[model samples]
Target: MQDKSKEAAILRSWHKNVEPWTRAVRESEIRSRVAVSDAAIVNAIIAQSPKHVLDLGCGEGWLVRALADLGVTAEGVDAVAGLIDRAQQRGGTFSVMSYEEFAAGAWQQAVDCVVCNFSLLGHQLVEDVLAAIATLINEKGRCVIQTLHPAYSGEPYCDGWREGSWQGFSEDFSDPAPWYFRTLATWLAMFKGCGLQLEELIEPLNAESGSPASIIFVLSGSSRK
Candidate 1:
């Protein structure tokens, strides 16, 4: 029940934050994103040299636009209609679809890559989405995920729920959504459970602090095992 409400709160927060969120991405307001995670996730996906990529939970579709510019056929889907509208207006193919819809196999085409860039925010729902992604990609395909490292969670390192906030951002952002946190071991176990094998774990660093700004997990279908 708690998980369900937190999940719903996430959607509500995004719905209310479309404008500020879009502006932040467009203006590169987030320091961590501007400094490292954005390039890290993009480079990780490009390394696979995918032909068609799906940007799951893609907010305003900056990643889609970026990949499209690099000649990849990229499509983005978001639960928020406003974000999808903004994404379409800005360029790139986008649709309004929730993670539940996606996990239920809403997207029929098999792609070479699927990226969830700091977008996997649910509990069991995220597990469902990961399983869907594993089956949605070709055998040789990969799923690139960029998210805050477990170490950054700052203590009592175990799997649980955590409240999210927009402390460092501008005043416009509000209704901060709560997010589920997973420790490193739990993360790996979840991937394995979803039939995804970890290909690489990249820790993109912040130049100033020299600590990892975020972690990138490069995973591939585990059928080869």
Candidate 2:
């Protein structure tokens, strides 16, 4: 287990830096080619028709807004108060809380779906987060994570910890938290150890570049051994 205090600190600093950068790119970020693949993730969640949903590290509440637009009860939580405040101002349901804090609480009402989008990176506590995700969902519930594809990310076939920064965007972005890169196999193993089963792994590719911009993992607890 990671030291909760230390994990919380890292989360806070990273998100504090990210809040403004994300705000600058809102809505426009979704139109990027890489973001087009996110549509697949959204489609998968909608197909599940979840009654209630939890979005971990939910930045700016775009996913929540989309889900609510479909009549699904959705709530978002982020460590950055700036992002949470903005989300509320935009008429989205949001809370200012880190994943560690959010996961430590008792969610008596387990949700049908939990989404962790691109925020579960560079942390040794990812396994712990996965365990927490298990407790957040009900039986037959699913957890979906959309993140950088291990194969095509950074160096080909590299599996190790590396500090990451905002890139492929404008010079305006800065100070990203570090990332612990893992191969697809490593990710699957972590899921299994956390008492979850990897149901599917989808890589969203860039049409022009012929490279995957991100990967989405669909996981389930019932399938765990």
* TM-score top scorer: 1
State the TM-score for model 2.
Answer: 0.86
Per-residue error (Å), model 1, residue 70: 1.0
* Candidate 2 lDDT trough over 10 residues, lowest sum: 27-36
Tens-place lDDT digits, model 2, residues 93-186: 7887765565576444589999888878645567877888887777878998888888777665757666566565566556556567788888
User: Candidate 2: deviation at residue 94, Å?
Assistant: 1.1
State the lDDT at 34 in candidate 1: 88
- Residue pairs in collision within model 1: none
- Where in model 2 is the C-alpha error above 4 Å? 1-13, 27-35, 223-225
Model 2 deviation from native, Cα RMSD in Å: 2.8
